[model samples]
Every structure is written in C-alpha cells, then in structure tokens.
Target: MEHRELGNSGVEVSEIGFGAWVVGTDWWGDRSDEQAVGMVEEALDAGVTYVDTGDVYGHGDSEEIIGKAIDGRRDEVTLSTKIGYDFYDNPQAGHGELPKELNREYLTEAFEASLDRLDTDYVDVLQLHNANVDEVTPEVRDLLREWKESGRVRALGWALGPSIGWLAEGDAAVEYEEFDAVQTVFNLFEQEPGRHFVETIRDSGPDTSVIARVPHSSGLLNEQVTPDTVLEDGDHRSHRPKEWYETGWEKVDAIRFLEDPDHADGTRTMAQAAIRWLLAHDEVASVTPTFRDGDDIAEWSAAADVPPISEAEYDRLEGLYARNFDIDRDDGMDVLRTSVDGEDIEAAGLDKRAASY
Candidate 1:
C-alpha cells in the first residue's frame, strides 16, 4: 500500500484505509467483536494505516473496536472519527439525527465521547458528521480553533456531501479555516467531487487530501451488485434498497456489458476496474475500501497493483457510458449532504477557489 498526506494535517496514511463501520456494531444483524478486531489488525498488516469511524457508527462500537486494535500501535496509523449529527440527521433521512446544535455544548460532548470510545486522549483528525458548512456558526469555529490549539485534535473537518467541499469557497467557518481532511463517497458510480480536497495536495499549497469512503458504492461496485443479490438486513444499505439493486447500476451495468469478460483488458476484474476508475482520477488521494478479513485485503491490494488496462478498454468504457451510462440524477445534496457541490461553486465564490485546485 502507498501513503499520502491527509490534507495539511501533517499525518501520512495508507492510500487505502479501512473503514471501522462494519466492525464496530451490528449495523447488519450481529457481528463478532473479535472478528472485527481481527480485521482491524489485518488492515494494519496490509499497510492500511488510516481508519475512519464515527461515534454514531454502531453507537460507538466501531470506534471502540478500532481503539483496541490501535491501542499499542498508535504510532503506526492515523485515526479519524466524527462527532455531531448522526447518519440520519435529516428529519426525512432521520436515522441518527441528534436534536441539538453544533455550539460548544455539542462539540465538546462529541469530542470527549469519541475520544473515550476510541480509547485515545487525542485524535489525528476529528470531524463533524453530516454538517452544513454554510450553517456552521461562529461559536463552532471558535471551538474548532480551541481544539486544534489545545492539541486535542490535529485537524477539523466534516463528512458529508461533496457539495460541502464547496463550502471552502465561502468565508464562513471550518471550511475556510483549512480543515484537516474530509471523507466523502466517490466511486466510479458517483464521480463529481469538488476535487480541491486532493488537488490542493497535488499543488502543494496548504495541501488538503481526502479519505474517500464507499469507493465501492455500498457494494454496488462489487461483483454481487446484481438485482438478485441480497444485502444483510441490518446493513446501512437496507434503507436504500432502490439504490442497492435497481437504480444504482447504470455505470456498472454499462461498463460490464461492454467489457464482457469478468476481468477484461488482460486483468481488470469488475471490482478492480471500479477501483482503478477512481484511482485514475488525479484528485483522489486514497480510498477506504472495505473488507472482512486478510483474504479480502489480498484481493483489493492486488487490484491496486495491477497494471492499467489498455486504451481499447478505456474506449470501451467510454463508448459504453456514451451509449448507456448516465450521471447521478439524485439532486438531493441537502438531504444527503456532500463535502462539495457544483452549483454552489459560483454562489460561494468557489469558482475562483475551484481554479486554485
């Protein structure tokens, strides 16, 4: 595995990190704590030094499991966790929305809880989950400054829509203050990020990179994304059944149909092809592709090491997209917040900021 700096935080992590979401709790039925911990240890062995988790993941179970795995090997990895609103912060999308504001009250409470659960005094990067940068008040900024100054957190960020990445354009709160890192879901299926998150790093100016999660779209990019595939009942994906089976496969179906072979263009398996599609984008710093154990690690890592497929393959994918593929049509970033937004780019003066990236 390769390593890169996570924004300007001065922390270098494995290019491919492991997300602690699956290991922490029973988001899907039941999971073995020992098995989850074993996976964490395996991730470290695979050179996956970065781990992303949140207090709400499995209700702190994920963070706790990661804490145990990184207990003594603290120096070997970079740990990231989120506080504030839960996954279902949106009232409609309401899974874990806390009925609170992000004032000093929530920030402090969130941080302490996250740290305690992770079994660490300080975190490499601490973020607010599903936050709206435009709405981030002055008080929240002050607390972010305090946390950094106090050395309790090396950096501050948000894990939401790609649109929130556009928030950096506005002279508002943490976004302009130079957040440490932001985690967003960007894969071959959904590829429009404000790219500044990693391009800034490539340019070597205040250098901010990304910790991309769901590089596979909740397993849609995986081999089993066919309509017949069944997801575990408790999976976070259980809520988005339409996205899982019926609606999310324009790109995947297009590419697979055109390519024909499972690992086409000499050695591009569907999963590898999907992973490579993201890696090929210059803006992506690294990704946190998920796995269950050591054998899973071997497969993804192998995918990363494979040589790039031929131009004929690229043309095939391009032709397929032109003929059958379509861009993401879900325009509900407010409901499903992203770290960046395209329309807001001009609104927030991010068009000029966009140029810098």
Candidate 2:
C-alpha cells in the first residue's frame, strides 16, 4: 500500500483505508467476530494503515471487532471513527430519522464509547458522521475544538451524510474549522462530488483531505451486478430503485474503448475503474472499502493505479449523469435530497459537491 498525507494533521496513512462498514454486519449479514477481526488483520497486513469505523455500525460491533484485531499494533495505524448516525430504537414508535449526533455531550459520549470499543484511548481522526447543511452550531463547533484541545482527536472532519456523506455542499464546511478532511462517495458511476471537490481539498492545502467511500457504489459498479441481477431485500443494493438497480447495468455495458456516453467505458471492471477515477485526483486523501478477501483487497487497493483513464472515460460518465436527472451537480459534491426540490428540477436531486475547489 502507498501513503498519503491526511490534510494538515500530518498523519500519513495507506492510500487505501479499511472500511469497517461491512464489519458492522447489521442489515447486510452476519460475520463472526473472529472473521471480521481476521479481515481487519488481512487489511493491516496488506498495509492498510487507516481504519474507519462508526459507533452506530452494527451497534458498535464493528469497533469492538476492530479493537480486538489491532490490540497491539495501535501505533502502526491511524484510526478514524465518527459521531452521529445514532441507531437507537424509538420508544413511542418504530422508525428512525437522521439526527444531529455531534452535540458536545453526544459527541463526547460517542467518542468515549468508540474508544472503549476500539480499546484505544485516542483517535487519529474524529469525524461527525453524516452531518448536514445546518449552520455551524456552538455545540458541534465547540466539541470539535475540544476534541483537538484535549488530544482525544488529532484531526476533525464530517462524514458528510447518507444524503451528504457521499455528496455535499462544502459551502457548509467553509468558514467552519477548516474541516481537516471530508468523506464522500466518488465512484466512476457516481462522480458528482467530482475532481473539483478533490481539487478544493488540495487547494485547501495540507489542512484538508478527502476520503472516498463506496467506491463500488454499493456493488452496482462491480462485475457481478448484471442488468438481470436482482438484489435481495436486505441487501444495500436492494434499496436502490428496483428497475435501475437490477437493469441499470445495461447503461454501463458498452465497448471498452468506445467511451459510450451512456457508460463509463465498459472495458475494465467498473468496480476498479470507478475507484481508480476518484483516486486520480491529487487532492483525494484516500479511497477505500471492505473487500471480501485478500484478492479483492489487493485489487481494490491498487485501484489507485488502474491504467490511466481517458478524458473520454469521464465524458462517458457525465453522459451517464444525463440519464439520472435525480442527481444534482452541486458546487463539487453529490448528495441525496433531504428536503423538497425546486419547481424546476421537480424531484429531489443529489448534492454531489464535497468541497469548493
């Protein structure tokens, strides 16, 4: 694995970070604690130095498993986790909605819990998981300041959101705390928070970095997901529009070199090419996700160097954008619509800007 500077914090981590999302094993499926830990060990052995986990993932089981995996090699890697995206059951009813979990008390409690679960006292990066477009509040602003001041966290960032996490308006990030880093979705098929976001993070200098997650777009960009494939109900890919998720593969099935405007060049596996495109940006700190085994890990990690993509490749991707007007091309990021849309765009469009470039 290669190394990159994570914003201005001066923390250098492997270009490919280990995502603990799969280890969460909540809605997807179950993985034994031993199996999850083994995967973490595999990633670590593969030179993955940055590990990202969340407190709410699998009710913190991910953190606990990771904690056990890196019990002794704490100093060999940089650990990143988030506050927010709480998954507590509602007392009055059966439902859940995105909530602000970065308030001082909530963040503190979350951080402490994450630390305890990870069996670590401090974290390399403490991000507010899935934060939104609200103006900076004293609670979050002060809590982040405190995290740095207290040395419990070395850097700060926003996990963006399910709506903003993978796509967002960096405008909200500006004038905030310099937001040492930002994480979002930037796969080949999903490139709203495109190169511009990466450039902005780079332009921010060493003070800011970008982390790209879901580089595979929850498996749509992968090889196995064909137009005829049907995702089971509990699968994350199942959440996507049934027609598109199952049949959209046709849109990307084009000649490899032809650079079909409707597809991002179907030659190479979109899974690898998609992530490769995101990593091409000099500003992106890293691109990472969970791999089922060592082969996929090796393949996905090196996705950083998937033979140079063509400008035509990007244009093809943009053309794919045309088909999905549901996507909004914002400053430089992409996001899911949280509220109603304007009269013109009609339905909600994604906010794909990560930060201003």
Candidate 3:
C-alpha cells in the first residue's frame, strides 16, 4: 500500500487512504450497511487503494456505501469524493453546518450528483467540500479545469475543514497554483493548518499534494483516546473540548518517541507511529486514517509497510512540535476559523482567535 502521486497528478494515492467518513456516518461510531460493506471490503483486502468520500458524508450516504464497497473491484479502487455541501437545500440539522454551494451551476449539479452516488465513471479525487476562500470562484476555477481537462477528475482538491483552522482556506488553495491537492487537519496532534499548507506549498510553487485528514489526533495519535476514554453519545470526538482530550493525552505522551520495537522494519504501532508521523512530510501525499473497523482496516492498511519516521524520529518530531507537546496547557485550539478579514489569519503566523468565516 505505498502508491503516492496526487501532486504531480499522475494520480496515484494509497499511502494509507480510506477515510470514508466512517461510512454513512454515525459521526464515526455505528456501522451496518452490512457493517459498511464489510468495512470497505476490509479496505480492499488490506492494500487500501485510497477511498476518501464526502458528498456531505451520510447525506449521500457516504457515496452510497462507497458504491457498495467498490462493486466488482472497480479497477481495485482509488476513488475519492467531496462536493460543496448544499445538501440539496439543507435539512441535516443534527451535525449541522450545511449550505455551501460553490457555483458553476452548483458545481455542475454537484458533479453529476457525485457521479450518481459513486457508481462512478470518473472521480479519483475531486474535492472542494469545505470550500471557502470566497468559495473558489472564477467559475469554480473554470469548473475545476473542466474536470481535469475532461477526464472528469483524475485529481483536484481543497477539503480544508468543517472544524480545524482553515488557515485562509489553505492559503487560498496553495496560492491558486491550481491545486492538485489540499485536504487538511494533519496529525501527530493537529499541526497548524497542516504545517501551514506544507509551508505554503514549499515556499510558493505548485504540485500541491497534502491530503492528511485527522491522522488520529482525535484519538490522540492512535492510543484511541485514552486517559480512561469515555466519549460515547454521538461521538464526533464529542465536539472536542475536555481541554482537547486533556491536552491530547499529554500530547500523546510527548510523542512516545514515535513508538518502535526494534524497528529495522517490524514492530511500529502507535497506530503505525501515527502514520509514520504524517509520512514525514515530503508534501504528505496521503494519510486519511479514520477507518473504524475491520480491525481498523487491518491495522491501518499495514501503515504502508511501516518503519518510516526516522530522520532522527523526524527531528524528535520537530522538537516535540516546538515544545508545545511537552505539555504546558491550552491546546484548546485558541479560536480559529478565519478568512480575509483576519488577513489570512494574520498572514499565517496564526496566533488564533479570528473566528469569522
């Protein structure tokens, strides 16, 4: 399961993908569209060829249970979804926040209704769901470059959030160098706006690539929410604020030194060292991680053949996330959500408290 290429969009994907938003959502708990098509056929028998998903998640019923779990293997999967959520005239009040509609005739009738609920004929990454830097206009960037020059999307992204900091809609979709990817909420304890959209796409250039969603910071880098975990009722991490899981379980024990077990390539599971600390970011091509079943999709789709977090454990996780993880306190995400009025979260230095969107 090592794939890769979303940036130079020759379109690969599976370096541990499959976040079907916990398929047809109980917001990540219940499961039973035959256990969500047997947890996406046990993440396609563990090779996990990328799944994603979000046409307002359960509203389109998680792309119709990932089109019945990739019926007849659909060329062994690499799907991906997402379309700005109007939820077709909004009614979903429970998990709230709908109403988005990124123009171009409601994103071409919501990408042909997400290709008729992912029965598919296109879609290997489409994205734009949580869109908001003035809703990516210019006719939604020429209708996403005419659906990737007419193949109907082999790549194109932007899924920033319904929660974490938008960081000016991921720095205006990587400064509009026509994104090849962007999805956010990166892990090893929520690094700001996915390390400020991978350093604003490597100090300003394109080849976007960075699809890491909540790589387990919700479950605290994969200890599955400990400190006597009890987040039950409607658990979208129970709307996060028990001091953000007690300051994320003490920043997951100060990065448990990225868990090892005599690793020349064998034992590594703090959920595969929190997905090898976001694939130690060479622009993080993929790392979806929310697979809540089939033994969490056979231990994180074998975390793409583990053993990667090295460079001296990613420089001791960038000095334990520049010392915040050593546990001082307030990781209750200091009020985020900003847009141009906050001047792109104060030109991305991000001291927080903007909250406008």
Candidate 4:
C-alpha cells in the first residue's frame, strides 16, 4: 500500500487504512474477538499500514483488539485513535450519542486510559472524537500540543461525527491550522463538507490532510448493500431511509464506467474505485474503509495499486454529482445536524436543512 504523510506532521498513513469500528461494535455485525484480530492481521498482511479506532468503540474493545492484532509489529503501522466521548460514566443506549467532555482534565484521563487499553505508550495520531466547534478551546489546543511535545502523540486531528454533516466543525479545524488531519464521512454520493474542506485548504493554506471515512457511502458505492439486499435489525445502515439505498444504487449503476478495463488506468472494483475517487483530491491523505472480513481487506487494501481515476473519469463523476446522478428524487439526506443553526452549512453552500443535534 502507498503511504502518505498526514499534512506535514511527518506521520505517514497508508492510502487505504483499516477502520476498526466494525470490530469494536456490532453496529456493522457481530464478530468474535478472535475474528476481529484475524481481520486486523489480514489487513496488515495485505500491506495496510493505517488502522483507525475510537475509544468509544465498544468502550475500548476495538483498541484492545487492534493492539493485540498488531502485537510485535507496532512499528509496521501508523496507529490512530480518538477520544472526547465520555462513555465511561454514561451507559450506551443502542446507537444513541454519548456526552462529550473536551476539558483538559477529562481528555488527559481519557488518553491515558486509551493507551492502557491499546497497550501502547504512545499513538501516532490522537483525535478529538466528534468535537463540536465550541469544544475545541484553547485549553484543548494546548493539551494536544503538549502531547505532541511530550512525545506521547505524534500528530493531532479532529474526527468528525457520529454520522455525516459537521461542515462548520471541519472548516473551523482547517482554518485553525492546528490539526494534522480531519476525518469525515466523504464519498462520491455525499460530498458536501469534504469537498468544502478540500477547497478551503486549497484556496487558503492550512495543509491539514483529509481522512475520508465511510468511503463507500454506507455500502452503496461498494455494492455491499444491493437493491434487493435486506439489512437486518440493529444494523447501523438500517437507520437510513429505504429511499437512500434506492437512490444510491441508481447512482452506483451510473458510475459503472469506472470499472471498464478500457480506461488507461485499467478496471477497478466499485470499492476500489470509490476509494480512488477520494484520493483524486490532493488534500486527501487516507481512505479508511470499514473492512468486514479478510476478503474485504484483501480487495480494498490493494486499492492503492489499482489504476487511478483518470481526469476524464473524475470530471464525469463531478458532472454526474452536479446533476444528482440524473435521478430527480430525494436521497433522504437533505437535512443534517448542525451546531450553528445551519449557518455554517449554509455558508458552505450545502443545500441541506440544518437540524440541531
């Protein structure tokens, strides 16, 4: 896998990284602890050097599994984990969001606990998990810098969301230029804030790298949830409206040209193509697709080696996106949670209704 540095932090990450959320929680599906470790091992064997996990994931279960999976090969990967959510004192009610504490005292405690779970002295990247714009105070900034200076954290970042639509928070992070990376839900289908952030970096000059998560647009771009496929109860994707998948499948069919072998770069699986599309943006440093199993890792880990999306294909995609993939129907994502009364979303030119979280 190709490695790219996160901004100028000197922390390199694989082009295709493993998002350990799948294993940490049954949000995707249930997998035994052994199976989770095996999947991580599989990803490492396939040359994936970036593994991202959050302390809130199964209340640190994901990090522990990742630590076990990477035992004795710690130097071989660029490890990143997020904090901010205080799941310790709060009970997780299904997929309900938890209270976040970004104060220096709480964050310090959380970071130390995370290290204990991962069995590591330090992490390459430490991010604020789903931090609201106001939560990124000067005190938090000082704490992040302190960690970096203390050699406990190599880089600092802000991971956006419990879901998509944190445009204002992402923009503020880029403008602050304090973070090495900003992780978000960005893909061909849902390109609002990600596109906005990339342009913000280009037009201005933060140099903060973008980490594209949920690159498959919740399994649509990867064809994992086909039109006829039924999502079981408690599955995270089941929360999305049925119309979302219907519209997504239609859009996926329209982009099949990306899989044609006649392209100069050669053919690509829909999954790889989805990742490649994100990499086409210069600001994107990594794409962390949720790997469900060993086969999922094998196919996506090689995305860096596939023929890249050519300029023409990219333009075609932009055109399709401009026209809403030629389908005149709502994708059920028009309204998104916003912290600043939708002012930020409006400023970003995203035509979605802003709902208070």
Candidate 5:
C-alpha cells in the first residue's frame, strides 16, 4: 500500500484507510462482534494502516472492537478517532446531530475515555467530531495544543459535521495551522467542499492534509446501490429522501467515463476509479471508504494499487462538477435537516456562510 504523510506530522497513513462507523452499529446492518473484528483483520491483511472511528459510533463499541482487532498489531496502524460529542451522557443522540461539548474538562475526560476504549496510550490523530467553524474556539484550540504537547494526541484535525463542505470551518482549520488535517465528504458526486478545502490548504501555509470521507458518495460510487434499491429501516441511507437515490443515480451515470479502462489506463472497478480520482490530488492524505465485510475490506484496500485517473479525466470530472449536472447543490447543508431528527440549522448557527456553494 502507498503511504502518505498526514500533513507535516510525519505520521504516514495508507492511501486507503478503514472507516469503522458501519461495523460498530446496525446503521448499515447488524454485524456481530466477530464479524466486525474479522473485517478489521482483513483490512489489515490488505494493507490498510489507518483506522478512522468515532466515540459516538455505536456508543464506543466501535473503539472497543478496534481495540480488540489491533490487539497484537497496534504498531501496524495509525489509529484516528473523534471526540467533542456528549455521547457518554446520551448515547442515542440520533444521526449527525450529537450535542457538542468542547470545554477542557469535557475534552480531557473524553480523550482519556477514548484511549481506554482503544487500549492505547495516545491517539495518532484526534479530531473534533462534527464541529462548526465558530465552534472551534480558542479554548478548544488550546486544549488540543495541550493534548499534543502532553502526548495524548500526535496530531489534531476538525472533522466537519452535518455533512461535508463546511466552507467556513474548512478555511478556518487551514488558517489555524494547529490542525494537521481536515476530514470532509468528498466523492465523485459531492466534490465542491473537498475540492475547495484542498485548494485552500495548498494555497495557504501549514501543510494541512485533507481526509476524504464518503469517498464513494454514500455507495453510489461504490456501485452497491441502484435506483431500484431500497435501504433497510436501520440503515443510515434510509433517512435520505427517495429523491437522493434517483438524483444520485443520474449523477453517477454522468461520470461513467471514470470507469472506462482506457481512460483509467488500466482495469479498475468503479469504486477504485472514484477513490483514485480523489487520490490524484496531492493534498489528499487519505481516503476512508466504508466497508461491510472482509471481502469489501479487501476490495477497497486494493483500490490504492490501481493506476491513477489521467489529468484529462480529472478535468472532465471538474467540468461536470462545475456544470452541476442536475445534481442538488445545497452545499450539503440539507444533510443537517434531513439526516437527523429535530436538527435546527439556524439554531446550530449555520447560515449561508456555512453552506456557501
């Protein structure tokens, strides 16, 4: 697997990282502990050296599963996890609308709990889960700095929440310089915020890395969902409007050129093509593709070996994004209202600036 340094932190992570959100909960489906651990082991065997999980994921069950999976091979991977949610008090905060708590006492206690759950002394990368731009206050920055100085976390980042492309937060993260990376939802379909985030980091100083989550456009790029497909009740995608699948498939078909072997210069699956499209950018440090089982783990982990999409193909995608191509361009702010129950965008202090397209 090809590894890249996470910003200037000197922490090398595999091009394809393991996303542990699905395994920890039935949000995707009911996965047994053995099934979850087996998948992580399979990912490790396939050369995935970075694992991204959150404390709120299955209410810390995800971290415990990871702790067990990497029991004897902790050194083989760089563990990255998120905090800043009060999941400890209210485990069922509903999807994407977890209450934020960034005070020092809350943060310190949260870090300790995460370490205990992961069976590790220090997390390689610690992130503020789903924080808004204004939420990343001076107090939060100082606490993260203290954590780094005290060796609780090697590097720090902001994992944009309620969906990707929080332009204000992404810009502030890069300018802050304390952040080593920023995680966003960047895939073949949802490309704006991730693209803008990468450009801003490159143009600015501090060498912040970009971690692309939802690299498959929530399974559209993964080819696991079709227009006819119906998601299960517990599945996270089930919450999205039916229009999301109908419109998403249209957008997916528009980018079918990415899957052409000739354009890719070699044989590549649609999913790998999607991931390589993101990896083509020099600023993307890692792309975490969600996996369901050992087989899924192997398939995505090998995506890193596929030849990159040519610059011409990359430009084609850029042009498609510019045209919008019948895709909804709400800047992903609708995610806050639709994905979670009772989420108030205005109450969250998110307005036009936060959802700038």
Candidate 6:
C-alpha cells in the first residue's frame, strides 16, 4: 500500500482507507459483531492504515467495534472519526435530520466520548460531521484550534455534505487554514463540489488535502450494482428511488471508456479505475472506499499500485464533466457555483427536487 501525507498535519495514511459505516449499521445490512470486528482486522492485515467512522453510525456501536478490533494494534492505523450530531438526545435520528450541537461543552463531551469508544488518547483526524457553512462559527474554529494545539486532535477536517446539498458549505470551509482536510463526495460521476473544492484549496495556497468519499459513485463506478440489482429493504441504497438506478446506469454506461485496460496499462479494475481517477489529482490525499469483507478490502487496497490514468484521459473526463455526460437531466451534476473571490453563491441549475446520490 502506498502512503501519502494528510496535508501539513505530518500524518501519513494509506492511499486506500477503510470506511466503517456498513459494519456499524443495519443501514447497509445486519452485520454481526464478529463479522464487523473480523472485517476491521482483515483490512488492517491487508495494509489499510486509515479507518473513517462516525459517532452516529449504528448509534455509536461502530466505534465500540473499532475499539475492540484495534485492541492490540492501536498503533497500526491512523483513526479518523466524526462528531457534531446530538445523538445523545435522539439516538434514532433519521439520516437526513440529525440535530447538531456545536457549543464548547457539547464538543468537549463528544470528543472525550469518541476517544473512550475508540480506545485511543487522541484522534489522528477529527471532522465536523456534515456541518453547514454557517454553523462553522468562530467559536467552533477556536475550539478545534485549541484541541489541535493541545494534542487532542492532530488534524481537523470538514465533511462536506450529508448528501449533495451542502456544496456551498464545503467550498466555504476549505478556505479556513485550521482545517487540514475536507471530505467530499467525489467519484466518477458526482464531481461537482469535489472539483470546485479541489480548485479552491489549490488557489488558497494551503497544504490542505481532499479526502474523496463515495469514490465509487455509490457503487456505480465499482460495477457492483447493475440496473437490475435490487437492494434489500434495510439497505441504505434502497432508499434511493428507482429512478436513481435507471438514470445512474445510463451515466455509468457513458463512462465505460474508462474501463478499458489500456487506460492504466491493463492493471486497473473498474473499481480501481474509479479510485485512481480521483487520486490523479494532486489535492486528493486519500480515497475511503466502503468495504463489506476481506475480498472488498484487498481489491480496493491494491488500487494504489495501479498506474495512474494518462493526462489525455484526465482531460477527457474534464470535458465529459463540463457537458454533464449529455444525460439530459440535472440530478447528479456538480452545480456548485462560487464567486471568483471565494465567496459563497447560490448554485443555479441544481435539481433540488431529485434524490441526491
């Protein structure tokens, strides 16, 4: 596994990191504690040195499992987890409307709880879980700054959106020098805020990094889910309307050219191709791909070894993005618009009525 530095925090992480959402929640499926812990062990054994989780995942059961999984190997990985949801008040909050607590007291309690759950003294990276631009106030910034300086958190990042509606929030947060990274949904298809975020970070002259989440376009780019693939009722993907699958497959087919082995000297799989496409950019520090088991972990962890796509292919993707793949609809397009001076502006042509990916 190839490792990269996470901005200027002096922390190094594997190119492929493990996303612990599925193992912690029935939102993906019912995964037993044994299976969940084993999967984390498998990922670590396979050289995945970064693990991303949230306190709200499975109502904090995910963090508990991670604590157990890394019992003897705590030093082997850089643990990254999120806070900001007031799960203590309403543990059963829906995915869309989890109430937030940003005051100093709540943040202090949340961080201590997260550390206890992970069995660690300090988190390598702590993020504000899907906070809006307005919610990231001066008070919040000072609180995080104090924590980092005190050695409680080595780095700080802002998770862009709960879905795709918070693009402006992402753009605004990247300008802050205190943040070492920004986690955004950037894959083969949903490159809106990701592209704009990357460009913003570069222009600002900060050593900030971009953590690319949903690097597979929610499984489309990975070729794991086809048009006919049916998700179980409890699966989060099932919440997406039927139209998402239909329209998503069309967009996936449009980018089939990327699957050609010639693009990366024949070593890349469809999934690796999707991840490499994001890593091709200099701003991207890590790609957190969701994994179900050891096989999934091994496949994605090896993507770092695949040769990167040529510059010509990267330019072609840019052109395709500018045209929105001619999909004829505006659902998954990255319509995040901002001012030249880096001020937040309302994005036009964004289909707010459509279900976000």
Candidate 4 lDDT tens digits, 50-169:
999999999999999998998999999799999999999999999899999999999999999999989899999999999999999999998898899999999888999878888888
Q: What are the clashing pairs of model 4?
A: none
lDDT of 3 at 63: 90
Candidate number with the higher lDDT (2 or 5): 5
Residue 239 of model 1: what lDDT? 57
By lDDT: ranked, best first: 4, 3, 5, 6, 2, 1
lDDT by residue (tens digit), candidate 5, 299-318: 77888877788878878777
Best by lDDT: 4
Off by over 4 Å in 5: 91-96, 263-265, 326-357
The TM-scores, one per candidate, come to 0.76, 0.80, 0.34, 0.98, 0.89, 0.90
What's the C-alpha lDDT at position 224 in model 4? Answer: 90
Computed on alpha carbons, the lDDT of every model, listed in order, comes to 0.63, 0.65, 0.80, 0.89, 0.80, 0.79
Q: Please, what are the lDDT tens digits per residue for candidate 6 over residues 221-310?
A: 887789768777656666666666677788777777766756445667778889999988888888999897777888888887777877
Off by over 4 Å in 3: 1-51, 54-69, 72-80, 84-101, 120-127, 136-158, 161-165, 168-183, 194-256, 260-267, 275-297, 301-319, 324-344, 347-357
Ranked by TM-score from best down, the candidates are 4, 6, 5, 2, 1, 3
Which regions of candidate 4 fall more than 4 Å away from where they truly are? none
**Cα deviation of 351, candidate 4, in Å:** 1.7
* lDDT of candidate 3 over 116-177, digit per residue (tens): 88888798788898878887878889879888888978888888878877787777777675
Candidate 4's TM-score reads: 0.98
Model 3 clash pairs?
Answer: none
